[model samples]
Target: MDGTTLYAVDGGIARITLNRPGARNALNDQMIGELLDALDRAKHDDGVRVIVLTGAGDRAFCAGADLDGLGRDGMGVNDVRDSAPFRLFTAFPALGKPIIARLAGHAVAGGLGLAAACDLVIAADDVKLATPEVNVGLWPMMIMAIINRNVAPKHAFKLYYTGSRITAAEGREIGLVTEVVPRADLDARVDELAGVIASKSPLGLRRGRDAFFAIEGRPLEDQVAYLLSELVELAGTEDAKEGITAFLENRPPDFRGR
Candidate 1:
């Protein structure tokens, strides 16, 4: 939408890159707006089967929110709730498609929240991650929701309270990072993963992702029931039928996002 963010689609994968390398690709209002716009576009585009979120620079995936634009007192509850970060992070999982975070550098504070929001987060092995809001006498109230879903409760609290950064390996071990690769191999790894996901039947991927998101705070029994129902529903989709036909015929399936 704007130079603050860059959006491109190629080979069924939509790449959303946060600009502003000088600021470590910080989430300023304009950048956030542009990123949200890009996400909305990618979500609706039938050609885009997968989304990859990354930053422009090698120094940091994101240094967090742009404090200069936030003013002296920073944001209040209403401001935070209305901000693009809140909407982007909270609404991401429900988009009915997979999103992968390609992190080649540090992701601190709200940056970590953005990474966690994605379905998969692949980071460079040397990357740093943290939620250091408490160090500034503030709390990562909004981000904690997404972070808690990934990290263990005690470990999440430790990151929030101590303002200490963790390595990509530790982040993966704690469930925050999906994969860790050497910096030089980050792009290859991300590409490999994106390519694999992009080859799936779009209809099945959407149904599966949506079903999983729908069961998020539900009981195990409810989750299983919903998943079973979703499976039956998916079996009725045109793409599912085509996939089965292709498998039986020894041919590649052609999914139309049906």
Candidate 2:
């Protein structure tokens, strides 16, 4: 919103870009606030069915927080719970719409958390992802929750302990990245994937996303019972009825987010 980030919606896709290319698109307080604002805007916009998040530069998708600005305002332990990064990461689960991270370059520290928070991550083959906070005498405390959910404990521990960078391919292998494409094909691939996701029923997508997050950490029996109720409710929606009818008629369904 303040030139620190860019927000644009076209053809049901909201593109939120980190604009501090000169600083490797690092997150400062202003950038983080602007990003949260963009996400909120997209979340409330009915026309936006999908979100694409990326940085403005080729050098790094995001190099993480701007360390120089961390304590500029005398931030302390008392402020950790209300920090912008904490709110941003927590916002993802409640956003309802799908988010696809476009990683054309490196994603490190909190940047990797940003990608992991998304529903999908499409990275360039040359991209590198890491949690190098240990190298700087700090830990990725805020992003640890997000990264852990996306990656297995063992692989995540190795990254945290060694402060090592992994290739995009390795990231996919370890479940942090969804797909890896060549740099030249990254934009096209991401766009294609985003388009496909955007064409789905908005109500279905929102309810399904909500259901998945709701079922996490629940007992197996409870999860199945909850999902069964959700499925029955979803099947009764207008979009679902239309989708079923259209299938029988060999035509595309017109979903109105119902």
Candidate 3:
């Protein structure tokens, strides 16, 4: 664990928390680096079947990037694309495991991007989300790619143009959030969802997730052909064979991630 982030694993779920509640869990360079490291650690850990990302307090999942920290080193506009936050944003799709964002509070700017990048977002009903970079004389540049993928173009444009905050229910309706529950029920809901994902075959989950990302933007025929090939390959894995056998025997499958 680093100062900016906390990492823990239990019951096949890796929990990575942004530990800067004092700063509303804003992303600084150090936090971004630590977050990427934690994600890498979880990705390589065979025992970790699912991941949950949240902040240290109920006030915010993350407020946004640390604006005060930006340009501290005379950073140029062109260099923004190569910054730590950019790398962290790109890292999510390559993890090959389900990531659930537990948004107990507001997720703004890059924070909203972080939640949108996750495979699923379980947000507290009281929470708000926004891409309010425009309010600060900037734009949600780095997060736009991820956000656009999750939210419809018109809705995304509205967010970028208005810099308005939307409720968790609105976020769900716009596809930014997977589910929303009362604040009291957030933890229980996240755990239940994570536990169910972790119980699946790890190998299957990994391959299936990889395919989910890979087939994006491909021609319809190409996507179908690629998925067919993937299915054939997956069917030959030991875990797949075991899964089929277990189904026939009316028992739970013991997947070894083979």
Look at candidate 1 and tell me the lDDT of residue 109: 92
Stretches off by above 4 angstroms in model 2 are 71-79
**Which should have the higher lDDT, number 2 or number 3?**
3
Tens digits of per-residue lDDT, candidate 2, 67-104, equal: 87544432464776576767888999999999999998
Cα TM-score per model: 0.94, 0.96, 0.96
The residue-by-residue lDDT of candidate 1 on 64-121, one tens digit each, is 8898864322345556666566677777976777999999879999899999989999
Best of the two (1, 2) by lDDT: 2
Clashing pairs in 3: none
Cα TM-score of candidate 3: 0.96
Q: Per-residue error at 255 for model 3, in Å?
A: 0.9
Q: lDDT of all the models against the reference?
A: 0.88, 0.92, 0.92
